[model samples]
Target: MKKFILDLIVKENEHINEDYFVLKLTSNDKLPHMLPGQFVEIKVENSPTTFLRRPISVNFYDKELNELWLLIQIVGNGTRKLSEVQVGDTLNLILPLGNTFSIPGDKNSRLLLVGGGVGFAPMLFLGAYLNDLGYRCDFLLGGRSEANMVQLNEFKRYGEVYTTTEDGSMGEKGYVTQHSLLQKKQFDMIYTCGPTPMMQAVASYAHKRNIACEVSLENMMACGFGTCLCCVTDTVDGNLCVCTEGPVFNITKLKWQI
Candidate 1:
């Protein structure tokens, strides 16, 4: 897919919590097609300490409104600057970067999406996409606390929403891998994005169950293109750039010990 550099107007900047915000952006031109698991690189203007653009996952896209949603976690100067932008501010972005999650051919395939922390960003878009195609999607999301879980209602609009929190402040008190939903039901495919450790656990569980699984890696990225080679990961095929080759890969291809 071709990439574009555009100044997207901030339709809204929603503060989900102290650590996270959702930026809804629109363009004078129609928004480019974006796929689940893809991301955007946003230029941080006026931030002297931040030189590189931050890579953010596509949270959700409202085609009817021509809006692109970005779920951002303010972890550094670049993101902090991004969070400060007001409604109607223009954010320059290179978007629809990286490979997307695979869509199962069988519409009847049962699917589960697992997400943790800020990694929950991409799952929403993936679920919505799958739902639109008549696939049933069940979501298992985790956070340190209830406060970390955002967009619960929005997720429910797509499928069954389940949650876990380390502090027991939400649906269940445990990691997503430990959620009882896994034991209660069997799925044909599983897709996950989150911390490496958490994803590894999910992959191991799926592997043992003979279920197909794919994980979206959150390796540190810069340039949002493959040129920087900063987000390369070892795979069965060889080292590959997460930016260009994938942010998403099947568990079987990954060199993870599981």
Candidate 2:
């Protein structure tokens, strides 16, 4: 698909917590189509320290509203600056970049969606899209505690939601990989995005059962167009740019230590 650069106005800037926010953007022109696993690179205006744009996954999009949702964690100077923008502020972005996750072709396929932190960003889009296609979409999300878990209610709108917080304050008490459902390998495919350790564990578990699995890598990206090679990861085929080639990779395609 072709990519486009546009300045989208912020329709809403909702703070989910001190560390995270959801920015809803609308374009003056019609919005370009973007898949669930793809991301956008936003120019960080007015922040001197933020020279490069930040890459954030597409949380969801509404065609009728001409709106796109970006679930952002304020982890650095760029995101912190982005968090301060007001409604009606225009954000310059180059987007609809990178590869997308595979959707099930079979209507009755069962799938497990796993996420952690802001990595939970893309699963909502993937799950809701899958659910609409008649696939069983189940979510397993992990955070440090109840205070850290954002958009639980939003996730539940798409599928059966299971949760795990490091503190025993939520649905399950450990990492998502420890959830009993994951151990059973009952799903047709597993899709995950999160901390490297968490994703590695999920991939390893699925690999052991010979189950299909895909992971979205949140590598530090400089140029979203893959010019910088800053986001390349070691794969069986050699180093590949996470920005252009993926933020999503099937387990078999990756050469994880698993």
Q: Which stretches of candidate 1 lie over 4 Å from their true place?
A: none
lDDT of 2 at 231: 97
**Candidate with best lDDT:** 1
lDDT, each prediction? 0.93, 0.90
Task: Give model 2's clash tally.
Answer: 0
In lDDT terms, how accurate is model 1? 0.93
Write the residue-wise lDDT of candidate 2 on 93-164 in tens digits: 998999999987877778999999888999999987787667788999998888668898998888899999
Q: Which candidate leads the pack in TM-score? A: 1
RMSD of 1: 0.7
TM match of model 2 to true structure: 0.97
Question: Could you tell me the lDDT of residue 96 within candidate 1?
Answer: 83
By TM-score, how accurate is candidate 1?
0.98
Query: Per-prediction RMSD in angstroms?
Result: 0.7, 1.1
